[model samples]
Target: MPCAAARACPSFLDKSIHPHVLRHSCAMSLLQAGIDTTVIALWLGHAGVRSTDAYVHADMTIKEKALALNTPVTAQPGHYQPTDKALAFLDRL
Candidate 1:
């Protein structure tokens, strides 16, 4: 059914999807499944993790959701309000 739709409307395939599009889709799917962005960038042959940001730029909402899911849980929630100890540690560096 999907192939038929693709055939009917080339635009549906986004003007003939290239192998890179398939690669991008695979990368995005892996990312959606909780895979690390750095790993995805490596798998997709990106020069750097920053290159992978392009795929994410198209969808900020999804990016936010991914970040929310992946963020580490702390004892307290809200934002990371650094403690005095943390401030001192940062000051040292």
Candidate 2:
């Protein structure tokens, strides 16, 4: 957290900070900045980009944005299809 404190405000992070916390924060920041995971992995000195996958998938908010972009514009919201088993149970009820 010393790295973050030096670069920004020490009050930015409330929890106890460890040295490795900065590495994680840096990786997440890179992801938010739209840097490719592969590049981040290389920057972090990882042997393979696969090691950086955790950071790539860690943020649900990012995933939601990506999903939103991929969704068909023609598709309307709030239309959920129940599974076949659920449909059968509902019929019995």
| Count: clashes, candidate 2 | 0
Error of 1 at 21 (Å): 1.0
What tens-digit string does per-residue lDDT give for candidate 1 at 10-85?
5786667778889989977887776878999888788899988876776666866867887778644455578999
**lDDT value for model 1:** 0.78
User: What is the lDDT, from 0 to 100, of the residue 53 in candidate 2?
Assistant: 89
lDDT of 2 by residue, 5-93 (tens): 65587665666778789999999999999899989999999999899989977988788778888889888865479999999999999
Per-model TM-score versus the true fold: 0.49, 0.65
Off by over 4 Å in 1: 1-15, 64-93
